[model samples]
Target: MTSFTRPFILAAALATLPLTALADPSVAPAKDSLEIDEPGGVPAGYVLKWSDEFDKPGLPDPKLWAYDTKANKHGWANEERQYYSLARRENSRVEDGQLIIEARKEDLKNKPDWGGQHYTSARLLSKNSYQYGYIEVRAQLPCGLGVWPAIWQLPTTDHMMWPDDGEIDIMEYVGWDQDTIYHTVHTGLYNHVKHTQKGVLKHMPAVCGQWHTYSLTWTPDEIREGIDGRDYFRFVNEHTGKGAWPFDRPNHLILNLAVGGTFGGKTGVDDSTMPWQFRIDYVRVYQKPE
Candidate 1:
């Protein structure tokens, strides 16, 4: 249900922070030096592969990112109400060294693909794809009911339908469930509709009010998801068949902030919470040297 169908497909520094630090939403957190394997805490053998520090203040680097608005005319998956805008600075921008993906309560009535939606947002896809690596993102989440923020990955092959090529949810946080964070993996044999998706929910009381690191260390044998250097979820290749593990193919990254969907708006959207934001400090990927 969290699928970004027709999608293309498509950091982090602080190992941990004190509980007191999580209370302030305005106080910025320390920036990670991202030296060597410190970004995702991968093994020393891994080398820096790619990264976007969001240093330039404007749209995301065109060389490394592209927009995904293929399903804007129609509604997005999970019954999301937001229209993913294309190259719109109002929805996606870089400022003060961070990538800000904002979900605003506005209607793009003039756009050809408007579709009568009241909210506009952005969904960014990585221009490059990878088979295996340690990927990391440090971000601060937005709040208020109806906000659904995510950092995930999907296969690059347009031929492979979802749940067949595999999906890796590095992090998912719905504003309605403001205190918990989810990490999951889906495949033909294990998905949400079937009530068999493999996932883990962790209590992150200040997730929406402070900065946190979310990451995926993907290898040939398994995929591990972690936060602030602590692993919480992992999926090991069962070697049974593609139904259970279809992750060998190249996959790209996705970063989006959806609104009023089945998961985020199940309880109903809070209009007062308009203009929610998902702030990304940095994104880094690392892989072993060839």
Candidate 2:
């Protein structure tokens, strides 16, 4: 199913000596240094409210995140290939001051809830939800055909189905389209299944191999998305009712790396790219001071 219909949500190579070695470190430029001090630093007028630096190693902090393990049984709403593992370090973990969500090709057939899938990954949802704020994530994306990584949000209220409640795709990248990044917003009145969603595609050639910030500046009036602090996508409150403007309600964050699905599977997967990693340096949310 297309992301638009799913209720559940959830690479520029380095220049190198040889074609295959383009992404190899030996010939590529030095690794992009982490600007931890102020990576996507707090916006000018907003004050930091919460953040996860992944300073402590092991699984993500339980106080800030929860796993969406239920989707493993039926393959989520998109027919994704990987099982969303819970509390499994191999799927999601923190190391060297960063959070890593790794997708691996493995046979989980022996496990009852495996769903006969050959891959395993993780989907993390923030425990705290907010109505509006400046949200930012600094990370390096994964590349290879069939990989789908996303940083997005969904309404926090239960029983609030998609579209009707709203979905915000702060950042989405398909491995097949290595040079572009997508930002989209979905609502009952505007969604992809209907080919009416409000979205934008930005050419970011270095996105997959370097560290960059993906952010959203949301308010009662509008929602703005950006890369590296530069706003590139915006959706204003149409004042047409909840169908078009659900930003007034609180929403929780989600970070996940999915395998071949409707969009990600368009060109088919390269099993050779069996292992991929989505590294997140940090995530911070800021809001106007009360």
Candidate 3:
């Protein structure tokens, strides 16, 4: 599912450390510096378009964003370990021009719990949806065992059923090799079963603790993923019916910080690590032109 977008974070700096942590179940959340919409400026005709400045300090802005509560009860193919709530302070926050999403190893208020996991945090998505456009977000990811941070998109029509509906992982990291990041695409044809891999593994000069421009350029011709404005992976649709790339449909935006599950165990979540933060500077969307 190209779903699960989360905001709320700070600016990250170049840091070199082992990707996984040794389970600290009690480490307090770290502070970050993700300056929100600080006049990054826009290209002419590209338009400022849309964004979540996150300048206010509190819950996510009701008008521009909402939560995918389904994740709290188990959503996405990963079956991760966090319960996503709407605009919850414990999950998301804004301070000093940055938005933060802190996932912690703690019990939740599981009322009508749908087999929810022991982790707690936030997941946010853009209230609006689009099919073809250029979407970009500058952010600093969280680092800790079992920590999974991402910047991606999902169907706008709400593909209630995944796989059949399709899921795209623009950027998904499992905290194992903090130096490496991934960008994957999930579709009906080559899904969790086929063991197909359609992505680019970017080995950043440093881990995600540093601020960088991560984005996607989508058009009728192709879907490309990039970091720092450099294209590393791309996929295109073929009407001839050879390869399968079904990402032309409308999709919404998502930013999230997940804990642990199938993809995270390569290192393992350090449950002892409490309150890990994801800092975001700003999110900007641009239309390629009609």
Q: Which candidate's lDDT is highest?
A: 1
Measured by TM-score, the strongest candidate is 1
| TM-score between candidate 3 and the true structure | 0.78
Off by over 4 Å in 1: 1-40
Candidate 2 on 51-129: residue-level lDDT in tens? 8999999999988888876656555555568888888898999999999999999977766777778899998888877
lDDT: the better of candidates 1 and 2: 1
Question: Model 1, range 1-290, lDDT digits (tens) per residue?
Answer: 01112334321011111111111111121222111222336767987788899999999999889887767776666677989899899999999999999999999999998878999999888887877888999999998998888898877764546666677888888777789887777778776555566767777876796999899988878888888887776677889999989988777888999887667776889989778889999999888887
When summed lDDT is taken over every stretch of 10 residues in candidate 3, the lowest stretch is 10-19
- Residue-level lDDT of model 3, residues 116-223, one tens digit each, is 567787777777676666788888887677788877776655223344444566676667667876766655554435445355566775675788878777766666
Please give me the total number of clashing residue pairs in predicted model 3: 33
Score candidate 1 by TM-score against the native: 0.86
TM-score of 2: 0.85
Compared with the true structure, all predictions reach lDDT values of 0.76, 0.74, 0.62
Cα RMSD (Å) between model 2 and the true structure?
Answer: 11.0
In angstroms, how far off is 76's CA in candidate 3?
A: 6.6
